[model samples]
Target: MKVSLITATYNSEATIEDCMLSVLNQTYPNIEYIIVDGGSNEKTLKYLNEAAEKHSNIILSSEPDQGIYDALNKGIAKATGEIVGFVHSDDFLADPSIISAIVEAFKAQEVDGVYGDLHYVALENTAKIIRNWVSEPFDHRLLRRGWMPAHPTLYVKRDLYKKYGVFDLNYRIAADYDFILRIFKQPNLKFHYLPKTIVKMRVGGASNKSLKNIIQKSKEDYRAIKTNHIGNWLTILLKNVSKLKQFKS
Candidate 1:
C-alpha cells in the first residue's frame, strides 16, 4: 500500500533536515513524501529544495498558511496514497521499518486506523530520552479520562478524511485531539493498535512550551469536547491533566 507522509513546516531550518532524512530513509519504498511549508524565510526552503532534487517521490510547497492545521489540510488534499500519516518538522520516525510495519498492520487488520507509542526526546540532545508515552487501545470511556494515542503516531485511511472531515481550523492546538476523538468515537470505524514506538518527537512543542500555552490548550481541549459532543467542561479538564503522567514515563 502507498502511504502518504505529510510534514507541515515553518522556519524549521533548525531541525527539519533530520525529519526529512528520517522519512527519506524509511524502509518502506512505496511512500509519498510531501512537505507543506508556511512561507519560511530561513534556510527551511533551501533544505527543502535540496531534498526535492534528491528524492523523486518528494513534493514541496512553500506558501503562507493560517497555522499547522491549514498546512495539514493542504497536504491532505494533495495526498494520493491509500494510507495517510504525518511527521512534524521537529519529529522523526522511530525506526527505518516503522512505515513498513504500519503497512503490514493495515494489510493484516483491514482497519481504518493504526497507532503506536511515542518517545519524547530532548531537543538539545537527541541522545537523551525524556519519556515514553505508550497509548492505550481505543475505548469510548477513555475519552472522558483524556486518553488519546500520540497524535504523531496516528495514521489513518485516506478515505476516513473524506468520510469524517479534516481538522477544524478554529482549534489552535487541540484540533488534532478533536479529529481523533471524532474518528475513534464513531462505533462504525475500526481501529488497530500497534504495540511499538512509531515516532520520536522533540520536546518543547508549541502546545507545551509555556504555562500560558498550557492554559490556552486547556481551553481548546474543552472546546474540542463540546464541539465533538464528547463530554462536559470538567471532564475535559481532567482528561488534559491525565496527560501529565506522560512526562513521568
Candidate 2:
C-alpha cells in the first residue's frame, strides 16, 4: 500500500534534516513525503528544499499556519496515500524498515490502524534513549483506564481520516489526545499493535516542555475525556499515572 507520511516544520532547522534523512532512508519505497512548513523564519526551509531536491517525491508547501496541528491538517488534506502517518521535525523513524514493518502488519491483519512503541531519545543524541513508551493492542474499554498508543507511532487508513475529520484546532497542546479519543471511541475501528519501536522522538515536546504546558495538557486531556463521554477526571488521572512506567522502559 502507498503510505503518505507528513511532517510539520516550523523553526526546526536544528533537527529537520535528521528527521528528513530518517524518512528518506526508509526501506519502504512507496512512501510519498509531504512537508508543511509554518513559514519558518530560520534555516528550516533550506534543509527541506535540499531534501526535496534529492527526493522528487517530496511535495513541499511553506505558509503561515495556526500551529503544528494546523500544518498537519494541511498536509493531511493534500495526502493521497492509502495510509497516513506523521514524522514530526523533532522525530525520526526508529529504523529504515519501520515503515515496511508497519505495512506488512497492516496487510497481515487487515486492520484500520497500526501502531507500535516509541522511544523518547535525548535531544542532542537520539541514540541515547531517555524513555520508552511501549503500547498494547487497543481496547475500547482501555480508554477508561487512560490507555492510548503513542501518537507518533500510529498510522491510520486514509479513509478513516476522511470519516473522522482532521485535528481539532480548538486544542492547543492536546489535539493529538483529542483526535485519538475521537477515533478510538468508535465501536468499529480496529487496531493492531506491533511490539516494536517505530519512531524515535526527541524529548521536550511542547506538551511536556514546561510546567505551564503540562498543566494545560492536563486540563485539555480531562476536557477530552469529558467531551468524548468516555471517562471522568479519574480517567485523566490514570492516563497521567501510566506515564510513570514509561521511564523504566
Candidate 3:
C-alpha cells in the first residue's frame, strides 16, 4: 500500500534535514511524502527545495498557515495514498525499515490502523533518551482510563479521516487527543499495536513547553473527554498521572 507521510514545519532549518532524510531513506518504495511548511525561513526552504529536487515522490507547500493543526489538515486533504501518517519536523522514524514494518502489520492483521511505541530524546542530543512511551493493544475500555497511542506513532487508513473528520482547530494543544477519542471510540474500527518503537521525537513540544501551556492543555483535554463522552473529570487526572511512567520507562 502507498503510505502518505506528512511533516509540518516552520523555521525548522536545524532539524528539517534529518526529518526529510528519514523519509527519503525509507526502505518502503511506495511512500508519497508531503511537507506542509508554514512559511519557513529561506534556509529551511533551501533544504526542502533541494530534497524535493532529488526525490520525485515529495510534494511540498510553503505558505502561511493558522497553526500546526491547520497545516496537518491541509496535508490530509492532499493525501491520495492508501494510508496516512505524520513525521513532525522535530521527529524522525526510528529506522529506515519502520514504514515497511508498519505496512506489514497492516496487511497481516487487516486492521484499520497501526500504532507503536515512541521515544522522546533530548533536543540537543537525539541519542540521549528522555522518555519512552510504550503503548498497549487497543481495548475500547482503555479510553475511559485516559489511554491513547502516541500520536506520532499512529498510521491510519486515509478513509478514516474522511469518515470521522480532520483535526478540530478549536483545540490548540489537545486536538490529537480529541481526534483519537473520536475515531477510536467507534466500535467497528480495528487498530493493531505493533510492539516496537516507530518514532523518536525530540523533547520540548508545544504542549509541554511551559506551565501555561500545560494548564491550557489540561483544560482542552478535559473538554475533549467530555465532548467525546468517554469519561469524567477524573479521566484528565488519570491522563496526567499516566505520563509519570514514561519517565520511569
lDDT of 3 by residue, 1-249 (tens): 999999999999999989988999999999999999999866998889888898899999999999999999999999999999999999999999999999999999999999999999999989988999999999999999989999999999999999999999999999999999999999999999999999999999999989999999999999999999999878888989999989834
Candidate 1, position 224, lDDT: 85
Clashing residue pairs in candidate 1 are none
State residue 216's C-alpha deviation in candidate 1, in Å.
0.9
The regions of model 1 sitting more than 4 angstroms off are none
Please identify which of the two predictions, 1 or 3, would achieve the higher TM-score against the true structure.
3
Q: Rate the local accuracy (lDDT) of all candidates.
A: 0.91, 0.93, 0.95
Return the TM-score for candidate 3, rounded to 2 decimals.
0.99
For lDDT, candidate 1 versus 3, the one ahead is 3
Candidate 3 scores a C-alpha RMSD against the true structure in Å of 0.9
True-structure lDDT of candidate 3? 0.95
TM-score of each: 0.97, 0.98, 0.99
Best by TM-score: 3
User: Which run of 10 residues does model 1 get worst, by summed lDDT?
Assistant: 240-249
How do all the candidates rank in terms of TM-score, highest first? 3, 2, 1
